[model samples]
Target: GAGVSQSPSNKVTEKGKDVELRCDPISGHTALYWYRQSLGQGLEFLIYFQGNSAPDKSGLPSDRFSAERTGGSVSTLTIQRTQQEDSAVYLCASSRDSNQPQHFGDGTRLSIL
Candidate 1:
């Protein structure tokens, strides 16, 4: 509600199970982004949505990963047929615009068994 908010701070699922992570950005932010952080790795950009423009999916690791922003306020990241390699902290960030600094959420810790 105040800053960026992510659902289910932690998630554990069996391999091959699909999972969806949600992000609720600040009230008026126009830019939303999704990133993944492996154990010691830096944030890996996954996707970006700005206003009504087309989302930039260039950073997505595979076809099984997808994300969408709705009504310019909320976003969802869906991972299909999850694998062990997919286990990581999924982070969400939002900014007033693409040029502005972002506010990050605590992130969802996903574990694949």
Candidate 2:
């Protein structure tokens, strides 16, 4: 079973551009989480989705950040009008439950110039 996976391990883009990062969680997992990690920093919770719907969207930093999970499995984080401030490693994780340990994917590192 795939624990979790992300794409474009590294991405570089100009400011005001848009980017999409993908995540694939482990099978049968019902909880998905999105987090951001700046250089030399800890993971910052972004949004949380249960099944295929986002229930806790409190962590989205700004309107520029949005995400969606479909079929209760695959998820995508889309950044609109990307900015230098948006540069960070986007991480996705999933767990059997909120209290359970989440398995994290490598992450998608995005750089804005």
Candidate 3:
């Protein structure tokens, strides 16, 4: 139950609301990644956190989206001023290292009404 963990498998919110999605990676795993998949769309990379290095935030679409990893273990992705376009499945994955294959958990489905 520890390869990778995500909370609140599904969430529903009104437009303009803010939400936080959480991820807990396996012990000793130093790399974490976030992705988003919309209905009928391919998954898109959102961010990456590797060890103690600065997180790679380039993949995030806008300022409204951001993520942070604390103690290189758990991560939280926050979406501010959510929009209808934000409705999608938010996936989390982790790897022992950056070049290794990552293990993913069931994603959190966010719905904006």
Error of 2 at 54 (Å): 1.0
Q: What would the per-residue lDDT of candidate 1 be over residues 1-113, giving only the tens digit for each residue?
A: 58899998999999999999999999899999899999777889988899645468898999999888879888989999999999999999999999999999999999999
The superposed Cα distance between candidate 3 and the true structure at residue 38, in angstroms, equals 1.0
Candidate 1 TM-score versus the reference: 0.94
- lDDT: which is higher, 1 or 3? 1
Q: Clashing residue pairs in candidate 1, if any?
A: none
Q: What C-alpha lDDT do the candidate models reach, one value each? A: 0.91, 0.92, 0.91
Error of 1 at 19 (Å): 0.2
Query: Mind giving the per-residue lDDT tens digits that candidate 3 earns over 1-113?
Result: 55788998999999999999999988999999999998767799999999745458877999999888899899999999999999999999999999999999798999999
RMSD to native, candidate 3? 1.3
lDDT score for residue 86 of model 3: 93
Q: Candidate 2: TM-score?
A: 0.94
Q: Which one wins on lDDT?
A: 2
- Count of backbone clashes, every candidate in sequence: 0, 0, 0
Model 3: which residue pairs collide? none
Give the worst 10-residue stretch by lDDT in candidate 3.
50-59
Positional deviation of residue 26's Cα in model 3 after best superposition, in angstroms: 1.1
